[model samples]
Target: MPLHPRPRALPTAFVAVLALLLAAGNGTWATTGAGAQDRAGSAPRPAALAGRVIVTVAGQQDAGRAAARAEVRARRVYRFALNGFAATLTEKQAARLANDPEVVGIFPDRTVSVAAQTLPKGVDRVDADRHPGAAIDGVDRGVDADIAILDTGIAPAHADLNVVGGKACVTGDATTRDIHTHGTHVAGSAAARDNGIGVVGVAPGARLYAVKVLSDSGGGTISDVVCGLDWVTANAATIDVANLSLAGGGPDGACGQPTTDPFHQAVCNTVAAGVPVVVAAGNTPGAGRDIASSNIVPATYAEAITVSAFTDFNGRPGGGGAAICAASGAVDDVFAPYSNFGADVDIAAPGTCTYSTLPNGGYGYKSGTSMAAGYVSGAVALYRAQNPGASPDAVRAWLLGTAQPQRSGFGFTGDKDAFAEPVLSLGDGSFPSPTPTTTATATASASATSTATAIRTATTNTATATRTPTATRTPTATARRTATKTPTRTPTRTPTRTPTRSLTATPTRTPTANTTATATATATATAFVSTPPPTATVVTATATATATATTGTTAAPYRVAASGRSANSNSSLYLYDRKPATVWISNPATTPPTVAFAYLDLGSAKPIGAVRWLVGADGTADSFRVQVSNDRATWINLTANPLANGPTGTWHELRITTTARYVRFYVTNPNADPRIGGFAEVEIWP
Candidate 1:
């Protein structure tokens, strides 16, 4: 693993001899592959450049070229500028030529292969959705950034992915379209478009370029990989990020010196050009432990932002669906079973059953650290796009600093240092303006108005309006029921007993016979059960309790946003209007769509007790799940089963126990009429 000395210069005598041989036309080497040979009369075939081995020579560029040409018909690929030239030569010829003083080493072109590998959750988990300018003019705007994927090419026409352009290092023609799905999938994970038909990527707006080092069979060699890296380096200024999902060979200490490992050297040069690299922490299927020391190439390379996989078994914590593996407790953000981990891993992302784009116009699922690295690549693109002048070090710092701390029990069994790998948590790009105080103030006013309305109704209806403070305060079970059916009148009845206590008196003074009993009944009933306006006194008390469920809690109104919504009347804004009567309905087109998700960004992390929902007067989803996320990506499910009890015109409150900056309500399945979904309002409890 020790560093090797730099390549040495060739002898002047050897160079002269090689020049003489080339001048005498004594070096005639045939090319390899289909249609590689020149016509009988055509100028003697130029050295085959395709599929040629990159020969590292101990000489100056001109001398190395002269020596290679003298020994065999060689078409230079790298031009020996980096002390190496890819040339066409048979195994026997290469072996014979190695004895020359100018030729230092002859390595068989090793075939590198594509490493086979999502989504709003992964995007939100990394907080890419929170990136500044994510949405502009009513549409989600992608960052103006570019990333290169060095794999099995890409399908630029894939509907969900946007590939700018790329080069192929494979045999024959130079087309970068994906022959294998690996590169396509990796590309999708990193920058699939935000178009509604397929999955959205972590940075859906970034331009993607493919460096096809791997062939259709998912195999290529070290030389091919270096070729791809060289291309990436050549255009580093245009590519802010690069992701290498493929990994080969075991680690042999630190990234070896350039003289010993051209791959490392190429990657080093690429990073030096200001483009950050992300690579997969290679997988170890049955071992269930760290493989960092296995000498994984790009991953172990010091410049890479190595990423490991975490199995978001249920997509969100506490939620359930098909799992990548059997995992229990705190499974949402657990480390993936097959992921490699160790000191080298820089971070982790959801890689289990990640959904993304595929080649030939389709989409599919794959799981691996390859997918995880793509997510990081996308994250880096977002960061670079937002901070165009940021250096590689600054980008890495921001990425690492904002990562969410990992829990030890979350399925990770790697070294303690590996377990500490931070789960990526891209913070909201900017602090949201604090919600207006008028929002809460309005809720208080509504409570008071409802109470007054109820009392006035009582005054016009029953003589009990004049009952004693104690008598009016103690409502019998039957009376409470009637009060609920007419909530407006209920509060009036309570204060009737304390008219002497003043109509503006606190409602709690007239304690119900059993607060627990009242809560038990109302808690189970849909919020839609028509109730008289709550007396300002009692409503204030209940609201306070709901808001203060967590100690030192601060309740702020949230900004509502939906993946799909109807016209302006039912827009997402209505969800936060503090009026249970005002509703926000989804567009009919989104009913059974792939992702039926709506969210509220609270601007800042807050502890929430319950989420209140008013199912639309039109219809409600048969079942839906609520999830929470600090970064808006790695959502934690707050419920065990999707709630399906709401009927049209009913109000339901799901009691959740978690703290997050964003909360999402996802419809798991459509109703009888899938396209007919609606919601009157969604409220976060204080």
Candidate 2:
């Protein structure tokens, strides 16, 4: 039978946009990895260990001789929701299909950069434009272009983001309505209309194409993701940018990595054909690599622009509404509470307390690097809308070309303003080599007083107190259980002729010999088990000097800082600013309680937000704000902090972290004040 103009909704469990991802998720990815690879030829290439995706052919391949040819090529390959093809091809089979003219293309299972958006300070409630929607962040906000946000799904009914071009994969019995609130939220961040409604997108007028990758629960593999990429690459002519707010087990985000990896390769394929693939970095901090290092996959590739997340200080609920999403603090990329972060993270953007559209037909708030990445996607659309003839490389050069310099702070902390250059002010690409130049910006006060904005002219100012990042090489996994015990063994032996004048009679090994042999065998097995194999688990963070903000002194049990408060269910882990303190109770039955502050700093956030399992030991199990007298010995902050409740669910702790010496303590009041708890690193920027 011949095919029709458009393929009907096949009853097969193919990949359609899963329910718009309502659950989630940036870094601004930037680099030219070609030089890096050329230099790294001696080193073995990083293992391609991303989860798998299968390719199908109309026919099967022959084994020994006269192999069969692929009769028909698949139009698109799906990922996340739609999974497992009937045809499981080996490397050779896959090679054959890749080379086949009839075959379309082999795609990866999922998009790189699943951890793009950092979880916002507020986990429970979310809505776009908490206050006013004005573009006062030094960037022109109005423009139109074509952008496709492939995620869970979107809510077309949302007043703010009246997105056009909404469609789902609708492969199976799934009615193809937005199930997860994710897709709608992401789309709203990217393409929400400028109409006086709820939220304002980065590029409000930009055309939208909703593409679902993950399912409603927000779990997905790689297949459906590849299908969405294929669609973008094929439709590059119509699409100025394709915002992929998803990642697999590996790297890349909101934009595909330029180097390799299936997703990044697809991004490269699109780049070759003049399209840009934007991706999300993911939600795992410290779990990923450093912002400039290895937390790899496509997002880290040179071509992609990974966007990190931040809270909207301008849109603080009842205050002024925000236009372009932006945060005003040094903890910009300080890792959203739940966002996964690492060195490969490129840049950061607004993600906290974001309100957007849902596919089913309503609106909601989404907090993750996913929201930040959407801002970049919309920005790209606007840029391409203005400069349609710009090359992929040119666009890449321009984004980083005009990116503001965000310095990584001291002590394994992440970077906030790494890509903090205002978009409108950014239009030039100067850094053509490994050494990127930093454009200056204003270091504004919390009150946002009218200060002299840091002007970044064509002047060369390398007078930077930038701390060179140091790599820590502690093996992530400890030794596994080694079996050690005496065991009985059986052995067979034959005696040889002695070197005496006469041949010696052989003593046959009997029951006693068997027992000794058994002991030897057991010892050998124990020794073999004792040795550990090399399982790589690298922890990435760049904590340098971070200046805590002195949020005006407040009373106890407050949610003032949004983050850093124990009273609230979730605390924003970005800034070092002091949060209102709550009380913690001491009970004989219950152990001491401590507040959590993530140390993930820099362009991307870090992991190590919460300490290990609670323990009696004070040092390892507490959260601290150190009062650095000299950078070495420090005092513990948050001591005797007030608590909101009886410390059943959790306790509230707050401290005013600053640039110089200050009164700092830990969350522990029962413990000696001389003994400080712990402090996860935060960040400061240029």
What TM-score number comes out for model 1? 0.52
What are the per-residue Cα lDDT tens digits for candidate 2 across 1-686? 11112222211100001112112112122122211122344522222111243342222322111124533233344222122131334555555544443332233444222332222222111121221122312233444466667776555555555455633442331332456677667776666666554555655545666665556655554545555666666565666776666543344333232223344445555555566666565554433333334343444445555555544434222223343344333242344554444434544555655666666455566566677677666556655665564455434433442343333120112333232322211212121122212221211111111111122235642111222122121111111011111111111222221211111122232221001111110001000000011111111111122322222111111111111222211212212221112111122224434332222112112111111111112243233332211121222221122221111112122122222211212244444333222222122211
The per-prediction CA RMSD against the true structure, in angstroms, equals 24.9, 26.2
Q: In model 1, state the lDDT of residue 570.
A: 30
lDDT, candidates in the order shown = 0.51, 0.36
Per-residue lDDT for 531-589 in model 1, tens only? 12221112222321222233111232233321222221133433533334444444466
RMSD of 1: 24.9
lDDT of 1 at 494: 15
User: Highest lDDT, which number?
Assistant: 1
Q: Give the TM-score of candidate 2.
A: 0.43
Question: Which portions of model 1 show Cα errors greater than 4 Å?
Answer: 1-53, 57-67, 73-76, 79-83, 88-104, 117-120, 136-140, 250-256, 317-332, 408-419, 429-686
User: 320, model 1: CA deviation in Å?
Assistant: 5.5
